[model samples]
Target: MEWLDERKMDRGKKPGKLLGNKNSKNHMDLQDIIRESALPFLPAKSLRRFTGVCREWKLQISTPFFAHNQSYSFRDVSGFFCQSPSGALSFVSLNQMAYGVPDPSLKFLPEPVDIRCSSNGLLCCQGRTGYRAYYICNPVTQKWKKLPETTANHGTDPAVVLVFEPSLLNFVAEYKLVVSFASDLDGYEFEIYSSIDGSWRISAEISFGKMKLLPRTGVHVNGVVYWSSSMGRIFSFDLSCERSTIINNIGSSSLGAVNGKLHTACLLGSKLSVSELSNAYTNTMQMNSSAKQWQVKHAVTLNFSVPDLYPRSYDKETVLFLGGDVVVIRHEKKLISYNMKTKEFTEVITEEDTYSRMVPYVNSLVEI
Candidate 1:
């Protein structure tokens, strides 16, 4: 392979040398093994460059099967797409060497968009102008699909969440968008848009009592979508059964998924507490009984002092649990991450203005 020849030249070796005769079956078998084992593990950018080595490499890398495998194997929180209060978007790389996007501001899209939610590598954005249309896009591949307008009215500030899970058994990149909006009757209503059907449908289940679902607080775990409410309650909707239920209150906190389980992170005084919802899926399906309680997972006190870190009003403070160990805290204009395992605190970035939204992103090749 030409990629191998480049590596050989870097090591001061002859470029044209081969392990054996070019037509040997054993040589081809070794090459196939290497491609199968290593190609999926590489970052999407490297794999894109490797496609130019030869037609065989291009064919192998472009397959949907390869993209599915690569999506699962290379899935990690690369960084966040942060949007300032003035609607300016920027990308902050957690590790610049390992991960980044070609266009952080998402200029490749048709119009300026406000990112509503992100799952896996796909981002669900709504057009800033012109009827406020919705769009699903993959930043890595620069591929996008605009969805047909929903029958239900998703208000100016909608409670939208995107759900996309990559599976080994399924190669198709399928996802769903769940929007909670005001209902004509008494309480809120849910309207879901599935990529499989390419249409929006109003769920039979409706009304989460009088609690108002908070915008931009939806988190998907397993097949269920959860949203925090202003009344300190949790509203859950199961995509499989199209049922909605209310989980027990856990006060005002941020929700995230870690190791396929639902977790909540809240700042109390000088300490940051992380808790997991044990038996989340099972409890979410059963609407009658009370959902499982949150078990304390990690409670790290903020030893270092920062101005107004634990302010009396927590409306601007946000906590996000990234991966399994790091807890990201956004206080005012400072973005800090605390490692649960290492017990270390690192300042990720300091923004010029306060950010209104920070969506964690993963670099993926999933086609829309």
Candidate 2:
């Protein structure tokens, strides 16, 4: 996370108090009031502008406390990033679409790259310019940093996931990039790159024996990362504990984070079954406890079948995101949402046939 070292300097030097009287008590009180009441509500774009309003505003917004509080406070799904097979990228505002407001297409990233995953507000992407080089970028801020290429060669199936913990840094940006790939001789390997160290190295290796790994299907939930194997086994890696465990009996399913807990959904017979971990703790001891089990939250059986979708599609559906009670599922060209409470499915309309990949998007001021 040395990319964030500059933020430490920013935090230490308080911009010389550009906005108010340096010696006046009333002006200091006014700044404090505005910082608490007004700043958090502003959009990331407006917040960036406010950073230029004065040294005080910039320092206030850059504080880790302010960033963390504002991030959790504004958890609304503001928009989504849509990509096309032709390589064009766009941002669709959910707020605008729901209100029948016409929105001009917005460019998502500075480069038209394939976005692998999103955490916090930043996206981990693969651009054409970087060979085996990954990019961590904030689409909202248009700020990006190309990550150092890993030492391992994964061939084609590199299981990559981005884990961004905004609370880790008090006054700067920080994130961890975890990559799992198979070598020609070594089988499966996991590597982690920390912004603090600014380098990548192998962390651990999984002895899957003869089992095959499902590529590009890793999900992070509650500080744990889950990846599926071909034999219906899910590999659970405790990021904090640096240990891996094999979960038995779960069939092909899409994994997602629902309310910061791990959730899995797969089709069983005619029903769409969704289940979540009973507890939120990711520690190995707690997860391995006998009391902790996956609790089925909702199961909805559809009366009709979607043509051209096989039974396996139930588990194969690309889970765009899971937030609150709504879970977004993408199957081929269509994107749909399922409500946990009502058990109703609704189609999310978008630019028809233009979407190749879609991920849940939130606006944030985090920059590299």
Candidate 3:
């Protein structure tokens, strides 16, 4: 170590002899103190200020040790509830459910938005109704991954609605952030997003008119992400292929296509099937049917007659039925959950105070 300045290190007249030479221990102590004081899990806000301290601190903050979202969950239906301008987002964790880790992708979200998933232990959130705001955040480690700044597409209403494609037999783990946006530009084009190479890029875009009944409720089947569009069309984003394919109209209007298609997702046997615009949600449309269209199966009538579920209200034409153990929904007034196994529908639960009063309105519930 370099010798201390002679004058400053004068030991003989010491008011406490020359202070021992600065060492790595002292350096590390300061880092430890700062980390312990400020919450590192939430980096969206604290990041700028934290890194502003110094270069060494910046490098240290970049490490995984300081960034993560804490796994704060609700034990039951009332365990934890998220609030959106529209309504609540609630989940009933099965006894078998396991929360791995809560990782923060961003320090602070621009505003309070929706929490799509904390899957694989990472919290994926987006802006509230009508705006395009989203970030990949881990609450535990507090490291925030990035995406191109998100904004709402004019035609599409709510900004970012996405899901993760978990690992399967032939595939590895990958997360997809799906956002519905209608560019104000020509074609008044409506497209969906798939976060590619750390950026939101257009996966599929189509000409969707005023009828905005498409269900952004995408479900992961095998390695594909299937979602319903505004006009009752079902589209699938295949990770393996990196392309979105229109899975022939299952039904014309279950989700919101005034033509009678519906919006919603359901799990059927091995294949993830959605309810058609027809009366029988269990039925699957016969692709390329000349006259006879969809045929109803007896597999599941999951949400056959339920309207007010999750975000809160759906009309006969604006809802999609899911035939599964549990069918979660967004209604016009609140968030509700239906248990097919139990044949029951839950009461209205609000995530935040705002959405509880806003009321979720369904444009169409035609089984698409």
Candidate 4:
């Protein structure tokens, strides 16, 4: 018993010392506390503050027993703030499209102006530094690699850029990286990159004059990137054979062609669908895969559409939706969310709307 409490005094001569008895009991209690805290499942919730308790506490917290609790499964940043499949919104960068998602969480990539959603959350991103010269980025984890600047160098230039992933289950899905660069000014050069060797190869020239600036949101399907140009041309690039071809002109000059940015979401059942914004205010468009192209499938009305033609629907500062849709829409100070399958839109919340002079802005919503 004395061995268990080192602070115990030799009480043979000093009968019963109250102070010594208290000290001995306190020493045994310290040992009991240490033993109880060593259990694996027991974790210190306030490990940071517990570390400042004393040097001993810090050492214990740093140990494997305590440190394990510090790890969080997911933390999303800037982009759309939405919960992951597991419902953990720890850290995420939802700001600058796919380019802004930081390291450890995603691949370091250049600023991509346009991005296409691929199978299993993978993205084909076209990021450029100067006029028409661009690199490619993947949004699955933000991995990126720069594509060759010159495909032909024939004084032609690429009017638009796109990246496509063809397969869903396998990494090497018959598809590859393709870009439409230097079409005329740079020499109508079509370039392709292989996932196996990481090389860029040029395809046979599809001679054409300066390409009409069309909607750059190119959708990838059946191993090709499809886009409708302002000059009224439907372009297709084959990833497997590394080829470029022109398809029949689709859509119409009569219908209001949204000059801003177009988004395409492909469906699986039968046809293709896309999300297009036409004459709508404060509504971030979600296009389905059933129309001639991706036409508006879901619409959320705004209190003020006004003249903000260049509508910044995705605000980097706010996490709109994380892995999935976080909001349906925001009117003035109120925010909303929607279900992708039910085709139903609902208001999630209402805020002060200070940024737009009380005008209201809900860029993107993702769980962080």
lDDT of each: 0.79, 0.66, 0.40, 0.37
For TM-score, the strongest prediction is: 1
Error of 3 at 127 (Å): 5.2
After superposition, candidate 2 runs with Cα above 4 Å error: 1-68, 76-79, 97-112, 267-270, 278-292, 300-319, 331-334, 339-347, 354-356
**Steric clash pairs (candidate 2):** 1-195, 1-196, 1-197, 2-195
What does the lDDT read for residue 306 in candidate 3? 39
Task: State in Å the error of residue 36, model 1.
Answer: 2.9
Better of 1 and 3 by lDDT: 1
TM-scores for candidates 1 onward, in order: 0.80, 0.70, 0.43, 0.39
Task: Give candidate 4's whole-model lDDT.
Answer: 0.37
Q: Give the alpha carbon lDDT tens digit for every residue of 1-368 in model 2.
A: 78588887776666556324556777778878888877775556557667888888888988867766666455545556766777666665544432111211224444446766677676787765546577887766566787887787755436777887566334566778887777556456678988889999787556445666665567788788877677776777788877777775346677777778878776544567778877434345644566655788777776544433432422344555665676666654556677786777776667656565565666776657
Cα error, residue 326 of model 3, in Å, equals: 1.8
**Candidate 3: lDDT over CA atoms?**
0.40
Candidate 1 per-residue lDDT, tens place, 157-198, comes to: 889999898877767788899998999987888898988999
- In model 3, the Cα lDDT at residue 357 comes to 18
List candidate 4 stretches off by more than 4 Å: 1-150, 153-175, 184-187, 209-211, 238-340, 346-368
TM-score-wise, the better of 1 and 3 is 1
Please report how far candidate 2 places residue 187 from its true position, in Å: 2.3
Candidate 3 lDDT by residue in tens digits, 72-161? 111111112233445344332211122212211232545555555333334565665444455565443444554566444533234333
Instruction: Report the number of backbone clashes for model 3.
Output: 81
